[model samples]
Target: MAKAFASQGDMADKKISFTEVGRDLWAFTAEGDPNTGVIIGDDSVMIVDAQATPRLANMVVEKVRSVTDKPIKHVVLTHYHAVRVLGASAYAASEIIMSDKARAMVVERGQEDWDSEFERFPRLFQGHESIPGLTWPTQTFAGRMTVYLGTRRVDLMHLGRAHTAGDIVAHVPDANVMFTGDIVEYHSACYCGDGHFGDWGGTLNAIKAFDVDAIAPGRGDALVGKALVGEAIENTRDFVDSTYRPAKRIAARGGSLKETWDAVRADCDPKFASYAIYEHCLPFNVARAYDEARGIDTPRIWTAERDKAMWNALQA
Candidate 1:
């Protein structure tokens, strides 16, 4: 029997947990769903990644209300994914920041991505209509940008391309905590649909070098101690390598896409079965890994049509 494509059958509501990873850094993690990071400064607050819809973002806002009434002045997008960026409008923030490359990616395929993702994960897009067309970044930086929320300094750096061409990480030097967007996910499948495998490995090494005590990764639970943080980083790197290596090997040998997909599943599913989105991400992850291994440096744009074609071809 053939299985449903993507997350079409994943309708169960996940348990969400909000924990503080640093002095004022909070992580809103929904089981294996996308996690949102909150950085509260003396006078204001900054949200690392917005939820999927305005209605969903409202839940995050309510959580913020529970903690403090500090105005959410900034919404930082870790990358240009619809699930992460579409909720920017809900925050009513003064500044919505993202990397320059991310802004370009939005301009290039925001609409396609919006449609493609909404179809892929219906549960995440609970209030899909609440998303106003596309979310654009009001401010964008090339490599690094620093913004001070009252005396607390938040450093946003684009170490290198990993999950996307413009993935960004938020570091709080004072607290020794970092908010690594989708660049690093703990106990969750790394969706490499639009990722750079080789570059992603290097980026993880860069993040591992940080002298941080805790971390709020893009997904999974917050890492409280240095040991747990290191473990998450190592596991994430291994996940990326495990998936890409098999697919790359198959591609190098002129194997079919189905062969590459089978190879990846056989190699990684056993190790990552308990991880979130493991099955949902496997097909796209293998496709991108195959393309990259075949010398395609830049990731191809994913559209609704292409998504379905690939899914049917691989999963059917």
Candidate 2:
């Protein structure tokens, strides 16, 4: 039987976990679903990534209220993916920030992404009707910016391109913890649909240089301790390398997309099959890897129609 298209079959709700990786630093994770980071400062709170919709984001809000009554002052978008940014309205944060490159992507392909993702995975967008519209960042920075939440210092930097060309990491210096959006993941597949395979490793290295004590990764459990942090970073690197190498090799030989797909599965399946969204991400990852190898530097925009076409062609 043919596999389901994208995450269409993944409708069951995932159990959510809110873990504390540092003093007042929290990670809201949902069984390998997209994770959100919460950083509580002296006076207010800073949210790392917003959930898919207002209803979904309210769950995070509820979690926050349970701990403290501090108003959420800032919403920092790690990148411009629909699942990560559409719920910005829920926070009512005074400042919604994104990297300059990320904002450009929002202008270029945000709507197409919203349409594509909503079609690809229904579960994430359970409260789609509540979404106000395309989330626009109130503020943007070029390379790095530091925000002081009272006395606490949180540094947001675009280390390099990994998951997407405009990905950023939020580092809390006092806690020695980092909220690495999707630049790093633990026990979950890195969605490389709009990724830069060549620059991903270097970005990982840039993150490693921080030697953070803990990390709230994009889609996995909150990582605490230096040992676990290093392990997750390396594992993410390996996952990226494993996916790209076989696909690149196949593409170099002028192989078909299906041929590249088979090669990627042969290499990645044994290792990543049990990962969350591994199957959902494989086709897109393989397609992007193949394209990059064939000299397509920019990832093609994925629309609702394009998503179905790609899934059908690959699953055929």
Candidate 3:
């Protein structure tokens, strides 16, 4: 059992732990590790967000088997991040699904993201060889889709952009649970370089309208109670506002990216300083916030070299 978030310190042996959230819903979590949600219907199961590699994803398979033998008939991608989408084949899912926009993101920047993320976090991609190729959805939906396991309904909705343009959430109305891709992370510094800050707050509100009894955030522990659900969304909103304010202040004053980072760190570090992957996320978050503040409507492509250049310019 690896202590959670040891990846934050480059500890190589950290393992993940998955928690059961409801009767047939399990929230797969690790210490600050990316999360995967398991939704069991009457006869089949669906996995939300595949892990970084097949080897890592198999660990979730083991955890799922501990509870049920039902085959995972579907794999629902919350977004297109390599860590979340690459190891999708490990599941028994015959039908892999994602939003229409998610499919386009893969078309647009999948390869670049794959390289960039590998450089940013090597520990997550332990079994890199197992990834066959860029994951493609067997089925894609535009606005919303309803999946059924007998009578159980899984409502997959694109509730506006937040973590990424293609970000979506799965709401089990009966269970009143939602799996928010990277849109809702608990006690973790959100990796928001690919995010839309202005719209994220609206997206959170959209999720809350579902009146979820519990939440399996993209990272961190499952929200056990309704009150905790509110807290998680609030914290996520705060992180965006905090990052944006400083970045905007710097942009407005015509300051350089380095100065923007410095301004943002004074507030973010003191508060989210100890969050999971806090250091790893700072440079990227600052870049997105800075660009958005300067009227950059679209997110800039983030290559590995660009990631390093930004980190050096801001952190060093």
Candidate 4:
């Protein structure tokens, strides 16, 4: 029998953990689901990547309350995916931050993404109806912006496009902790549905330039030390390479999408088969890789209609 479309069959709930990754940096992780990063400064708090819905984000809020009462002054968007940004209202933050490129993507396809992702992963959108609306970035930067909460500094930089064209990483130079949104996933499968495989590799290199002691990734466990951080970075790179390399070869040889998918699955499954979201993301990952390998520089927007059509074709 064919597999269930995307994550429709994934109904199991995951336990959430909040870990202090650095001096004042905290990571809120859910097994292998999307993760959120927290930074507490002397006077205020900043949250990276809000959860999918206000109700779900309330869990992160409760965790933040357990640590500090410094208001959640800012919420940052690593990219403009619904699961990442729709919960911005829960914080009532004074500023919602994202790259200008990210804001443009929201204007272009935010609604489509909202519908497409909600349909694919209903478990993640537990309180979808509670979301006020699309989260808008109050502040957008072209390349880099430094936000200071009293003496603490949070550097938001768009190194390059990886998971999405608007991806950004937050660096705390003093504490040496970096919140690398979806740009660097630890053990979790890198969802490449809207990714730029070639550019993502380069972006990972740029992330390596930072002298980070700890990193809170988009998914999986937090990297608490430099050694672990290095391993996580390489692991993420390995995943991308293992998936895209084979898919690219197949695509370049004029092979069909199924052939590309089969080639990548055969090569990467042994290594990443147990990773979080591996099964859910493989079809989309292979689809994007196949397109990029064939000279499609920009990722096509994934609509609800497109998602179903693609899933049906690929699953069969």
Candidate 5:
């Protein structure tokens, strides 16, 4: 029989972990599911990356309440993926911020992404009915912005494009801990369906320049030491490179997408087969890598119909 589509077979609940990566900074991780970063300041809290729905976001709220009573005042979205921003309503944050390019992506392809991802991974969108609508940022910045919660300073910057065109990172200077969204994943697969393969390395290098003490990565365990932080970054870079290199070589010879898929699998499977979401991400990553190698600058938008068509084609 054909394999289950996308994450349709992944129904088991992930064990949740709320870890302190810095003095007052926490990482809300659910196994290899999407992770959220919490930065508590003197007066309020800042949430980096809202969960997929109100119910999931509320879980983060419960964790927050365990520590302090500070109201969640800001929701900083690293990118415009549905899993990252659709849960903004639950926070009721006064300000929801994203990079200018990200906000434009919301206007351009947000609905399609919501539809596509909802179909791709139903587990993440539990309590989907509670989602108000596409989450829009209350404010948008061009390159960087500094947000203050009383005395604490959180710097948000759009270093470059990696996972998506509008990726950003939140750096808490007080603790020297950075919250890197899908731009950096510890052991989990990097979803590169909408990624920029050519510029991803430079973006990773830009992040390396920070030399942060710790990091709450997009997925997987919270990185709490310089050693682990470096490992995750370099591993992420290797994952991206390993996936793209073989696909690029295949595409250069005018190979079919299916052929490129097989090539990428041969190159990546031994190293990353056990990574979270590795199977779900393979087809899309190969598709995007194939496109990038063919000189496609911007990633093609993925709609639900296109998602099925691509998956079926690869499986065939």
Candidate 6:
């Protein structure tokens, strides 16, 4: 699951696992592959982050049916990313929900981002034809929105921006669990190409404010305790810090971008080398680091053309 514009497909490098982290809360994760969160309540189900296509989403739907026949009431997107939000139409939920910022990203650069991601990773979008175009949320919120599947309450909040300007988390107080989108990637690579570094750090800090007993990150296993939660946050922060420090150092000294990338790679690859999507993510990660190193805080919007050129330059 290299974050760079690599072949988009299901990550077949490792085994996939779906774990129930709390009561009626499940993390549909496959190593570093895209993960879908499930919330089953008294009356219906709520899916967090649809996979790449309806076909992929159905794989999750199939799994959901295996355990319960509850109707899926809503699809909550922590933020908008082609891989994260595209399969939303498959749920047939009453409404697709997203933060106002997430919606704006979709509106602002959805198509371009879609093209860029599709070109980068084709496997993730295996059933490309099954995707019903860009996934648009019927219900949008600014800060936070509380929805209930019968009496069970699920809180969606955009604590701050990190991975993207619209990143959010789904917290179920009763369950004592939280599903963080790309805001927390667990042991997987953190795709920061379209990210705001400072804001992303803040987002992680905000997530810690919740009294979560279990945590489901964007990818990887669902952590069971606060120690694991602490590990997730610390590892993510270290990755980000290691990436940014070199980018900043190189950019300030007016050093070569590739050199900066190599330096960061030497550092991060050693620690996260065996982590999910390391190969797929490094190119884009380096590019983003280079940009941030030069004080480019807000990640530049990625386009299909840009995707190709960047990959050729790095991987070539």
Q: Write the per-residue lDDT of candidate 3 for residues 148-227, one digit (tens) a residue.
A: 97678999999999989999899998888889989999998899899998999999999988878899999888897889
**Candidate that beats the other on TM-score, 2 or 4, i.e. the better one:** 2
- TM-score of candidate 6 versus the correct structure, residues matched by position: 0.94
TM-score for every candidate vs. truth? 0.98, 0.99, 0.96, 0.98, 0.99, 0.94
Pairs in steric clash, model 1: none
Write one digit per residue (lDDT tens) for candidate 5, span 130-184. Answer: 9989998999999999999999999999999999999999999989999999999
Cα RMSD for candidates in order: 1.0, 0.8, 3.2, 1.0, 0.8, 2.4
Q: Give the winner by TM-score: 5 or 6.
A: 5
Residue pairs with backbone overlap in model 2: none
Candidate ranking (lDDT, best to worst) = 2, 5, 4, 1, 3, 6
lDDT of 6 by residue, 1-316 (tens): 3333475544465466778999888888876788899999999999999988887888888888888998998999988999999998897745899999889889899999898888776777778887768889999999889998899999999898788889889999898899999888787888888877766777788888785898889888888899999889878888788777777778788888788878888788778888777767777788987887677867788898887777777766
In candidate 2, what are the lDDT values of residues 1-316, reduced to their tens digit?
8888889999998999999999999999998889999999999999999988989899999999999999899999999999999999997746999999999999999999999999888999997999989999999999999999999999999999999999999999999999999999999999999999999999999999999999999999999999999999999999999999998898888999999999989989899999999988988898899999999999999999988888888864
For residues 170-268, what per-residue lDDT tens digits would candidate 4 score against the true structure? Answer: 999998999998888877899999999998888999998886899999999999988999999999999999988998789877999989988998988
**Overall lDDT per candidate, in order of appearance:** 0.91, 0.94, 0.88, 0.91, 0.94, 0.84
| 1-316 per-residue lDDT for model 1 (tens digits) | 7878789989999987889888878999998888899999999999999988988888888888899999999999999999998988997745999999999999998899999998999999997877777998899999999999999999999999899999999999999999999998999999999999999988998998996899999989999998999999999999999988998888877998889988988989889988988878887898999999999998998988998899888877
What's model 2's TM-score?
Answer: 0.99
| lDDT-superior candidate, 2 or 6 | 2
Q: Record all residue pairs in model 5 with backbone atoms less than 3 Å apart, i.e. clashing.
A: none
Candidate 3 off by > 4 Å:
1-9
* N/CA/C clash count, model 6: 15
Q: In model 6, how large is the Cα lDDT of residue 131?
A: 76
TM-score of 1: 0.98
Q: Which 10 successive residues of model 1 have the least lDDT summed?
A: 85-94
Task: Give Cα distance to truth, residue 145, candidate 4, Å.
Answer: 0.1
Worst 10 residues of 5 by lDDT: 85-94
Whole-model alpha-carbon lDDT for candidate 6: 0.84
